[model samples]
Target: MEAQQKIREQPVDLAILDIMMPGMDGLQLLKSIRGSHHFPVLFLSAKSQDHDKILGLELGADDYIAKPFNPLEVVARVNALLRRVHHFDVPAPPPEPEAKQLVLGALTLDLKECVLYVSGEPVMLTSTEYKILKLMMEEPGRVFTRKRIYEAVWEDFYMYEDNSIMVHISNIREKIERDSKKPEYLKTIRGLGYKINAPAEN
Candidate 1:
């Protein structure tokens, strides 16, 4: 309660939470803060199980670091998360004059505003989800294997983290696809990976 109150009072750029806290667990704190805040949250927990990590991500945590983590690695992850959320890193120049708005079927992605619109209505997406969608939209019709997607968007080495990629993809589909089961734009290539259909000139 006291901690939450302090957080509410101060403007914070990021939050580092521990899962095993006395009285109220970190997950509970996360649930309470998430409603009003959109800042990045990282879980530093001893509960290093895969399910635990998945649960944290599902609950809107930006990243999870297990106990016994190297301090330098933790710092690196934190820096990466901050850079991603703040869009501080410079990207390579595009091949052509990038379109301000990318349209594919009913979906419209505003590259300048970093927002997604479905049928003229805005849709919310997490930073990770937006990054994935942006990558696909940038090069529609290009088959991006899971490894390539993870490496490109995460800017981290791909260690076969399938669940993390799959979960984010599922979330993106829920937001943009009229029927997630019968996705129109984002398509999966079995035995390969995924790709977004080429955007039609608007």
Candidate 2:
């Protein structure tokens, strides 16, 4: 109760919670916290079962550490999470003087609402796909290596997750390209990465 109250009172930078608390368990508390806050939450629990750890993460815990853990390890993990959060704390940019849209031959990206348009037709995209396409569209014809795309969107270190990025690119192409097999905008730079091209003006 006091913990929740404190959170409601002032800004919280980070939180460390234990899973086996008395009345409101850590998982339940995390759920409640997530409804109102976006701070990083780490779980320190004696329940070392795989299910318990996975459940904690599934409920929004950033990191889970089992009991009998070294205090030094806890410190290290906390610092790492804080650093990751700090990296993403970008300030809002000044209002753009130009129009809030990016355009290629027939595709238009609404920067304000994060919408994509195909030949004047509205196209829907999953949040992940929208981000990937936006990144490439911002710098058309610039090849973006998978590692760069993964890190930019996922905000994590890339671990050779080629299939993950590949699947997303495929999905995006299906929505935006006239022919996914012979993509008009997205191109695979074999042995390198991927890039989105602006269609030549007709």
The candidate that achieves the highest lDDT relative to the unseen native structure: 1
Cα lDDT tens digits, model 1, 1-202, are 7879888787667789998898789999988866666567889999989898888877767778889899998887787667676641134345556658888777788866567899899886666777889899888899999999877776777764547777777777777777788877788899899999843456
Choose the strongest candidate by TM-score. 1
How high is the CA lDDT of each candidate model?
0.78, 0.75
> Taking the tens digit of each residue's C-alpha lDDT, what string does model 2 give over 94-185?
67776488887788988665668999998855445667788999999888998998777656667544255676677778878888999889
Q: Give the TM-score of candidate 2.
A: 0.53
Candidate 1 vs. truth: CA RMSD? 5.3
lDDT of 1 at 183: 79
